[model samples]
Target: MFKRLRRLRLSSNIRELIKETRLDIRDFIYPLFAISGNGIKNEIPSMPGVYQMSPDVIVEECEQLKTLGIYHILLFGIPSHKDSCGSEALSDTGIVPKTIRAIKAKHPDITITADLCFCEYTDHGHCGIIDTKLKTVDNDATLEILAQQAVVLCSSGANIIAPSTMMDGMVWMIRNQLDKAGFSHIPIMSYSTKFSSAYYGPFREVAQSSPSFGDRKSYQEDPANRKEAILESLNDEAEGADILMVKPALAYLDIVRDIRERTLLPLAVYNVSGEYAMLKAAQTAGIIDYESVMIETMLSFKRAGADIIISYHAKEVAKYLLDRK
Candidate 1:
């Protein structure tokens, strides 16, 4: 008797029944860029369809996202001003905090995950304080600022604080500060194994956070190091991270799977802007089907063991899933 392995491939219904991995609308977390202004919804040139919206516009966008069944959003702020210490990130009236309050006031049901990093707030475009003399990011000083940012973000109604600085001991510091500030309920989603990659090129443009002088290689992990990635995730878990992330997901699915095996905490993978832009460019050139490729790429993340997917494609993915239903 011949083995009927082709039986499952015989029909679409059979394929769906045998599928081991599935993508859900709830698995996606959309990212938004919030700028300091009113009635602004400037599209990021490098990332098509992604915009830097004002607080009012952000609330409007969130309402739409809610209708699409995308309740979670990760916010990146572009302040109108910047300083050496990124003081605005800790200010009560800063762009992120102000945007948070606005979103909550209008849509209290949406969950906001604040991206806690100083790169956008600092004039130098580095993730943290710069040691002027040493010509490098001062890790300890950056930790202090990150902690303060976390508290302020939590106070402003952020349901989750995602620290993407890749600084050593940042998770512990933020966790400590949040508890001390009486925000013990807030969870920290640490970017545990962020790689230094060219894939972040488009993101730097959208966030206006490219380093003015040097690359982030000193702080972000090298893409070549697999063991180091796992170690980073382990350390963050020990430091009280509720969720751990592997950034630039397409190029690092192995790292995502490795980290997932090592920790019980939820794993999030960032499908960075460059990845989205590349696919968009391909589709525009008539080289591929945009919708089908987008769904396949997102399912790849889920197949690789990602519990949460943070992507610029979130809105599109949600719509596609809804259409399927």
Candidate 2:
């Protein structure tokens, strides 16, 4: 006897109910870039929808984000000071610490995940306390600073400390330090499969984190390598990362699916700034219908085994998804 499997494929309602993958508003983490100031809201010309907002404007932005049913946010800060060691990264009055305090005071329910990195704080735009001796990312020194940053974020009411510096043993160092600092409840979301790709153009503009002298090929993963992705994810997991993320999601959906096969941890995919800007530009040029394609891109991320999506498009996608209902 032949079995008929086309029954569920007969209609859209049946297909939806039986859908193996579904995207939701809560599955998103909207990324916010904060600069040191009170009222400035600088629009990133390269990335059509993102902005580098000051602390006061960031609070107002959060209010709009909350109304869109988006519950999670990832933060990147632009400091007022920079040094060879990125000393401001550990400062209590740093851009991120202040913004976290302000946002938490206003929107207590939002899951605030602060990006822990020294790139924005370092005058050279390196992501750690650099080693002038060997001229590379000093793993031990970076781990110490990363740990301190995590605790600072936690003290500022950040629920998650996302270390995007890609330093060796960073997750373990951060976890141990947070535990010692009484921030044991805060989680660490490691940007484990962060690739050194050209796809980060728009982010550099939004974050103002481009290296002053050289590139990050020494630390970020090589895009040509796939097995390295698994190794990186495993390292983060073994080091106590609560969640693992793959950056520049569209190009690495395969990596996302592969990493999904190896870990039970919650996986997040970042629809990076470049990807969003490119899509927005194409839509402006009438190459595609922006809203429809944007939603489809997000659905594709869900289908690719990403448990969370970090995107600048979160608010717009949330609105579109809501209007569809």
Candidate 3:
């Protein structure tokens, strides 16, 4: 006789009792884009529910997030000016640094994770300074500025520095500089396995970071190379990253699990803009149940061994989980 496993499947309560993977509101870190202005909350066309909010508006957003019981946020800056070297990123008074200060003042309990990358600040829209001859990013020069950027964010009350430049030795450089500056307690969340993918199209619009010239293929990993992806994350771990991330999480759940198995560090995954947009579009088209699909997508990340999820859908997920309780 066959074992009646259907007995467990019959009741929703039974399913909940035996569920192996679950999503918590605390597992999410919502992403916010801060521009240099007041009363600005311009929604991106491609991404339906997301917006580019100014510092003052962002502070108000924090208040709402607190009500939803979501306390963590990932902040990105959209500077008003840009130079070849992304000098704004190193400024003590730049968009992101100032925003972190403002957020901490009003919402002292909120945890801020400031993103450390130059693409949105640089005029060329590259992650860092470029080589004139090679026409590619100068990795060593970028590392120096990234270190300075990290310290700037930390000094301005950022609890974590997330480096997404995909530069070699980036984690080591930032960690050393942060320690010397007496921010040894601060954690570094490296975007370790970011790939050069088409899924980033919507992000460019909200970030205003589209490359003025060629693509970022030289630095970002090729999506086809699985071994290289794993090695990149492992290297970041060896270089003293406090956390490792697999970006564009849906297409790379295997990479998330692979890194999770190899490292003891907390693993994070980015549910990128394009992934968010696709689900929203399908919902708009009346093709799927948006809430159920979104919950399942988030559950997939938790099941794939991601300890943290940086997602645009974070707020919605938080509300959904709260309602279920």
Candidate 4:
């Protein structure tokens, strides 16, 4: 007798009942880009539906997201000013902190995860403090600044600090600083296995953080090294990361699965801008079914063992799931 798997696939109800992997609103962390202005919602050119919004607009967006049951968001800031030290990132009135306070004031129930990095705030467009003599990022100096940034974000009501710099010992540094500042409860989600990939092209435009001269290969992992990805997650875990992330999710599902097996800590995968852009371009060109592809892509992350997915697709995915319900 043939094992008829077709019985379960016969209808949507049966398929839903037996689906091994499912997408839930709670599994998503919507990413927002905040700029310094009022009433602004500038849609990113490459990322069609994504926008760079001002604080007031961000608050409105947060309220809407809350209504939709997408309780978590990851914020990236575009400060009005940029400097060598990314000083604005540590300011009480900086774009990110201001956006954080505004969102919390309006939607106190929402969880805000601030992206702790200097690239968008640095004039040089590098991730950290640069050593002119060495022509490389000064890792120790950047850690100190990251620690300060973490404290400021937590004080500004950020529920989580996601250090995306891929800096060495960054999780430990931020964790210690948070504890000393009486914010020991704030958890850290480290970008433990971010790769130096060509797939990051569109994100640079959205975040305005492309390096002015060189690439991020010095800090970010080489895309070719699978073993290194595992090591990176392990190191971040040892250094006090509450959650570990694999960036550019689609190309690195194996890495996501590998890291998931190695660590008991929660795993997050960043379905980055370029991944979103490619599908968006195809959808715009009528080359693929956007909704079907988007849902399938999100489910792949879940099937690969990602506990959390930070994606530009979060809002759409959440709405689609709600409609299905």
Candidate 5:
């Protein structure tokens, strides 16, 4: 009876009827690049159409995204200062804090999530507080700052605090610290299996969070392993991460699917900047239609089991979905 699977694709109606995956505006989380000043919206040269915008211009960007029916946003803030410890990450007066207030003020309906990492605010651009003697990011020292940063982000109206730092025990630390600081309701999205991939290069250009000295291979996962990702995801889940993410979605779809099959928790895939840049580059070269390729790229994540997708292309993809109807 199952002799001919090709029959299913024989007609458009039949193909639609048998379709296992579909794209939606709700599945997207727009990653906004927030800068430290007003009246500015500078483009990230590596990432076409992605910009580093001032708070005022960012509000305008939000309005456009809202009009496209994109509801979720993840913020990466560029602060005016940096230090060895990245203290600005926790400051109520910092770029992230101020931008969260601005976004919430303009659109109370939008779900604002803050990227809870210190790279954007650190001189050395390490994700944690570093120990120069050992030339390593101190796990305990980083957790202390992450907890405070979580509380401050919650106070500033971040609906979700996503810890992209791959530090051990970070989820429990933030969860415990937030609960104790009266922000018990705030959710923590942990980047459980962020691999050290070349796919993050354009993102570094966009967020400007690249390390000034050493690379992040010590903390981020090595791209060569899959079993390690499962172990890390399980660890984060047990430690109270409200959601788990596998970053750089395209190359890591196997891990995304692995996590999806293994856990009940909602899964997120970061369609990282470098991945987007590749598609953008190809589309510009007339190799493929941008909108069609973009839709296919996103729905691939859905088919592989991403419940939410944090993407730089969310706005464009959302608009495409809207026009389809």
Candidate 6:
């Protein structure tokens, strides 16, 4: 005598009622690239639907997101100037800060998360101040700047500060600085277990952050280490991170699940550029049904224990959900 699991699958209403995981527009944080210009909205070739927009254009995009009921956005900046220390990133007039103000002025209800990292601002495309002796990122020095950058971003009206530099003690320093600067209410979203993976190829093109000499394996986590991955998130949690993330979501869903099991904080996963580009390519080639596959893939992240999803597919998914209603 077998129990009848098939009974739940017999009807769409029953399936919906018994579903263990569900996808929602609120579960996503859409990523946007804000460059220095006006009237610009250039679609990234690799990431077809994504764009590198000027502040004006980005504000327009935010309006569209609001209409679709997606109120959260993660912002990355591309400065016209580059330097060894990434000095532009620390300025009050920097691209991200200006963009944040512009976005907030037009859409005060939108929750803006500014991504803090030096790779897009630095000449050599490293994540932080370089250690010439070791030819690697200077972790402690970078933490100091990260603290300052957090203050700058928060002052510009960023609702959340997301430090993606993967530097050691980053969350602790940023949290300390934010609290001291009278922004103790601001939450920090740390990219706790970012793996140095080839899946970031399209992101390099969009952000123009490819390292000039070597890879980020020196600072970013190695993809093959499981125990190390779990510990990384736990360390960030201990450092006072309000939220934790696992990057390259599809390839590391196990890590997401493991970290979810260990921590009570809200967990986020980055459905990165390469993953989005691959599915778009397959759809253009008529190899897959894009809409069905996209929904299924998003559900996979939820089923694997992701509470928040940052993805290039966010706008499209929102449209799909709106259509369903």
lDDT of 4 by residue, 1-325 (tens): 2458667347977777778998888989999999999999999899999999999999999888987889999999998999999999999899999999999888889999999999999999998999999877899999999999999999999999999998898999999999999999989999999999999899899889889888889989999999998999999999999999999899999999999889999999999999999999999999999999999999999999999999999988988988988
In model 4, the clashing pairs are none
**After best superposition, candidate 5 residue 161: deviation in angstroms?**
0.6
Candidate 4 has an lDDT of: 0.93
After superposition, candidate 5 runs with Cα above 4 Å error = 1-10
Q: Which candidate leads the pack in lDDT?
A: 6
lDDT of each: 0.93, 0.89, 0.95, 0.93, 0.90, 0.95
Per-candidate TM-score against the hidden true structure? 0.98, 0.96, 0.98, 0.97, 0.96, 0.98
Q: Which stretches of candidate 4 lie over 4 Å from their true place?
A: 4-11
Per-residue lDDT over 179-235 for candidate 3, one digit per residue giving the tens place of the 0 to 100 score: 999999999999999999999999999999999999999999999999999999999
Candidate 2 ranges with C-alpha deviation above 4 Å: 1-9
lDDT (tens digit, per residue) of candidate 5 on 133-248: 88879989999999899999999999999999999999999999899988888888899989988998988877778898888999999888889988999999999998999998
**Model 1 agreement with the true structure over 7-90: per-residue lDDT tens digits:** 734688878887899999898899999998899999988788999999999999998999899999999999999988899998
Q: What's the distance in Å from true for residue 283, model 2?
A: 0.7
TM-score of 4: 0.97
For every candidate in turn, the CA RMSD to the true structure comes to 1.1, 2.0, 1.0, 1.3, 1.6, 1.2
Q: After superposition, how far is residue 233 of candidate 1 from its true place, in Å?
A: 0.7
lDDT of 6 at 151: 98
User: What is the Å distance of residue 300 in model 1 from its true position?
Assistant: 0.5
Give lDDT: candidate 2, residue 7.
Answer: 72
lDDT of 2 by residue, 1-325 (tens): 1246667346987777778877789999999999987789888998876889998998998898888998789999988888889998898888999998998888898889999899888988889877887777788988888888788888888998899998889999999999999988888899999999898988887777889877899999999899987899999999999999999899999999999999999999999988988998998899998888998899889988999999988988888878889
